[model samples]
Target: MRAPIKTTLLFSMLSLCMSCSNTTALNKGKEKLKARFEVAGICSNYTFSLIEGMADTSLVAASWTNPQSDSTYTNAFGVKNPCDLPEGLKVGDEFYFEIDSNRPNRCMVCMAYYPTPAKKLNIKVLEIVKE
Candidate 1:
């Protein structure tokens, strides 16, 4: 009886250890991905509006087209600012749009509620000559 009980206990401990190691490995992978995303930023000409359009007042709706690739990204929402841009944005203005690489679905600064790593978004204006 004692031998059987010890065997069961040992098996349970080994299983628990395996699960813990797997969890640790998963956490490490997530951390690596987060770090990879942190260093990347995208630059484009952002088009915004002072009045709410597709996005509600709680959201900041904007769009941008990549100059090099001519790739158009539309209806991107900016994250809620601690200090609001009350002056608002012009309909067509270029900016150094900060992007959340980790959350690939939406723009970094103007994002719809999604999986984020508790990181703040950074959006900056970019000065470029018009063609």
Candidate 2:
């Protein structure tokens, strides 16, 4: 009876370890793109530019930066689901900036994964005028 209980415990521990390893593997790529957003502020719309692909002519990259930092990050911001940005961003609106380690030369806006009124980061609205 004692031996059987010990074997069950060992298998449970092994299963937990395997799950942890799988989680690590899944996050490996994202880990490499981790960056720091030390400076925060609003910048003019002129600072932001979209780069389109030659083949699809779709949005391939979003490059922007806060003038104070003087650093730019040019990482590819894919337009795919879960990575898409809301439209209507404009100048004079506030945006937190971050530097992606993978593309240290370009600076990008930092936005929350989801809009919130809770303790989450606030998503600034770029007010639009009626035509």
Candidate 3:
């Protein structure tokens, strides 16, 4: 019984790994959008917002609260940074990025009732264009 369970677990893990790899491979050649970091969200789901029209297509979601967008937030528009931001990156960083639906796996961020961009996108920072 124990052996069978172990084998099943192993196979399940292997399957998960394979699926993840496939997702990464299939995400290639996606449209790259230019945006600037607006501000981190109140929680995991609404982690952050961008000032680019391309990614700011959150029709039903809460629009940005930054001066460049909503103008009610405390953040600003400056450098080039995208989602999945680097460790050293900060708000206002500008950069070209590709949306990664397979990344930043769904997670909670703040109060479910609190407002957040309806289409909170996952981003894979391709390159920082901050000068």
Candidate 4:
């Protein structure tokens, strides 16, 4: 009886380990396909808009909107809030920004996944144009 109990415990541990490994592998694959964006040359005191694709509208849209204005400056895919990004971004989502580039600064956007929560990617802006 003791031997049987030990064997069952060992099997259960092994199964748990296997399940964890599978989840890790899946996350890695998802990360590999994640998206990244960057923008540079933003002048100070200006605003920008970030847009992400809308495929599964069910997924929450996360963004950081300027408090004084009605424009969204930063955004992340698969996240309900801009502050929830974990790392890099997922593919297919688009981000638009209107930055104040009087001084050089960096902006980023990305996608979110479970366990990690969200993946934020850095966006490098080569130039900031006025329209």
Off by over 4 Å in 4: 32-131
lDDT of 3 by residue, 12-103 (tens): 99999999998777755356766665455444322244445443333213344533345552222222223246766555777776765657
Candidate 2: lDDT over CA atoms? 0.33
Please list the C-alpha lDDT of all candidates, in the order they appear.
Answer: 0.36, 0.33, 0.52, 0.35
List the candidate 3 regions with Cα displacement exceeding 4 Å: 1-29, 41-63, 66-83, 104-115
TM-score preference between candidates 2 and 4, better one: 2
What is the per-residue lDDT of model 1 for residues 23-131, given as tens digits with 9 covering 90 to 100?
Answer: 8865542321100111112232222332211222233324434444454444444333323222333334333332222333233353333322222333232222132
Number of the top candidate by lDDT?
3
Candidate 2: lDDT of 101?
23
Indicate which candidate wins on TM-score.
Answer: 3
Count of residue pairs whose backbone atoms collide, per candidate:
5, 7, 14, 35
- Give the clash count for model 3: 14
TM-score for candidate 1, residues paired by index: 0.27
RMSD of 2: 14.9
Q: How far is candidate 4 from the true structure (C-alpha RMSD, Å)?
A: 12.7
Which ranges of candidate 2 are over 4 A from the true structure?
29-77, 89-131
Question: Ten residues in a row with the worst lDDT in model 3?
Answer: 74-83
Q: Which candidate, 3 or 4, would have the higher lDDT against the true structure?
A: 3
